[model samples]
Target: MKTRTKSEMNKIRDIAEDYYIRLGKKGRDIADMLGVTEQTIIAWKKGRDGERTWDERKRDMELTPLKIRELILQEAHKTLSGQKSELDADRLAKLMAAYDRLSKKTNPRTVMDVFMMFDNWMTDEEPDLVVKFTEYHRRFLFYIIERES
Candidate 1:
C-alpha cells in the first residue's frame, strides 16, 4: 500500500480515535480495520509522529450489567479450567457473590450498586480468584464494548 499523506493520516486518526474511545476498540483491532500496522495505532495513541491521542478515554468508559455477568462467568471459567487442584468454596463464593448482585437488582440504581460491588471485588485478593477475575474483565471489556456498540 502507498504511504498515507499527512492530511489524510490526520483525518483517519481523528475518526479512528473517535471509534477507539467511543466504541472501546483496541489499537490492534482498529489498525486492522484501517489497514495500518498495530504499531501505528499505538503510536497514534501515544501522540507520536504528530498524531493526536485519546486521552481520558478510560474515564469515559463505563461498565454495564451484562458486562459484569460476562466478567463473572469468564473468571469462573478461567479459574476452573487450569486448576490442578479442586476449586475451594472460597473461590466459588467470589463468583457467586458477583452473580447474586446481578440477580437481585430490579432498578437502574440498584444495578449500578451491584456493578460497584463487583468492581470492588476486582481488587480482592483473599481467594486469588477475584484478582484473576478482574484481569479477565479488563482483558475482555474492550472487545465486549466494541461488539455491543
Candidate 2:
C-alpha cells in the first residue's frame, strides 16, 4: 500500500482551494456553488485536508464551461489588469452561464492540452470539431498563463 503523507493531502486540498478561488465571484459564493462543506473549503485553503473529495472528472474530456468561464475571467484578470480591454459584468455573467450550460459534464484540458492532443485527435481520435485559439494577443497570453499558474 502507498503511504499518503500530510504534504500529499495538503496538495489535494490545494487543488480545490486554488481552483475554487478562481471559480467564485466571491469566495463564499463558490463554497455554496460547489456544494462542498465549508470545513472542506477552509481545510482546502489551509492545506490540511488529505482527502479532497468532490467531482474532479471535469464532466468529460472537454473543459467544462464553468471551468472555461473561470479560465476566461482569469485570463482577463491577468491580461487586462491595466489594459484598454475589460469584461463587462452582464456579458461576463451570461457567458459564464453559457459556459455552464455547455460544459455541465465536460472539462476542457487547456488550450495547451488541446494543442498537445491535436495530432492524436486528428489521426487516431475523431472529435466533432477541432478548435484553435491564438493567444489573446500572443505576448500577454503567455504572461497571463505564467502569472496565474
Best by TM-score: 1
Q: How does model 2 fare in lDDT?
A: 0.52
What is candidate 1's lDDT per residue for 25-78, written digit by digit as tens?
888889988888888887777765454446555443455567767766666676
Residue-level lDDT of model 2, residues 1-149, one tens digit each, is 46668887556555565465443334455557655556766555443246333334222323645467777687467545765435665666677677666655322335444554563565455543333223332443476466556
Clashes of each: 0, 8
TM-score of each: 0.36, 0.25
Which lDDT value does model 1 have at 146? 58
> Candidate 1: minimum summed lDDT over ten consecutive residues — where?
105-114
Q: How does residue 126 of candidate 1 score in lDDT?
A: 50
